[model samples]
Target: MSMVRAPWRGVKTPGVLRRAPAMVAFCAGLAVLLAGCATAAPSGAGQVADQGFVSGDGSVRTWDPGDRDGPVRVTGTAFDGQEIDTDDWDAEVLVLNTWYAACPPCRAEAPDLAAVAEQLEPDGVRFLGINTEDEAPTAQAFERTFTVPYPSIGDRSGRVVAELNGVVPLQAVPTTVVVDKDGMVAARVIGQIERSTLESLVEDVLAEEEPTGDGS
Candidate 1:
């Protein structure tokens, strides 16, 4: 239940965004035409709503092996219509990234994340996005533009974010969380994730020995 919290990060994403200007433009146009995308409401007391968005300081946090909490028991349906339950996944590591279509940091990290996910898939690492905002078309457009290889759960009800907030401070727009084989939150990047950082975090968890059934 204890972790080392370090925050503040930035990444280069102009290049990635440039790769699909038309897709970004299309999503942006949709956002404008739709009035505005639904912003995520905090399911608790402290809600950071500045300019309709609040981004984490891109800091990273890590919990020690013995200090990690029990597994996260969250279930949600992805935009692709696939049912996802953390408890049911059999991967050695899971990466949960919180994002929406218009969030700058989210957009910035998308390509890097997709690449890292693909690179780490053979290591039995899985990637899933938890989007608390955005409709199906907007979310899917970004996915297609970025060539995102994984599914993103539609957390429009904020249920999934609330479930995650119980385990960590999720008061920001783009946060990347790394879960170990035990399904416990092992590490988190509070803002846009750098490709190397994500790789290292997942790799660190992947390197750990499997947990014994009796809690080691």
Candidate 2:
């Protein structure tokens, strides 16, 4: 019997396969470098997102009336176990903030947020808090410490964040989103929001004309 030579004896390893890991690592590094160099665009009559936070820059942004998205749908149980939903805020200005007591920025901006809530109450504006990483007791304690006038929804399940997908990215611990009277997303302040800046955003939303019968 004649022995047949192996057909695959002369095959060589491809260069790409040999260098695959290094090439993949180089591509990942390049992606990070490009992201770091990217500049954020300004929106809504010069509202700009400045330097982001240390965890990540939560850039601020505002949308024009025509560019605003439809009302966000959100609902959850408050830290005190009370039911809360965005339906109650229809046709009214609303502010929603994501926070956790342990976050420094969240702690730093609590007082300001509380103050803003107090100041805007008379204007019929409503505020809601989303505690993304805290239990009821911790959230309640933080509310007590900051004298918060609004009820915060316990978002440990991430339900609220999921509902706010298109409206707010919720990337930062202390992100704030302002909804116009029409229930549309009017503005967002990423990271720790300042008292004056938040106030201005609310005022801008409140100043917008009420939606006509067509929901303009």
**How many clashes in each structure?**
3, 2
lDDT of 2 at 42: 32
Q: Model 1 over residues 64-182: C-alpha lDDT tens digits?
A: 98877646555677788887776677789988888898887678788999999999898889988887678889999999999999988776645455446547655566778888887
Pairs clashing within candidate 2: 52-57, 53-57
Question: What lDDT would candidate 1 get against the real structure?
Answer: 0.69
Model 2, 143-192: lDDT tens digits are: 99999999988765444554464344555467789988767788887666
Q: Which ranges of candidate 1 are over 4 A from the true structure?
A: 1-56, 210-216
Error of 2 at 177 (Å): 0.2
TM-scores for every predicted model: 0.72, 0.70
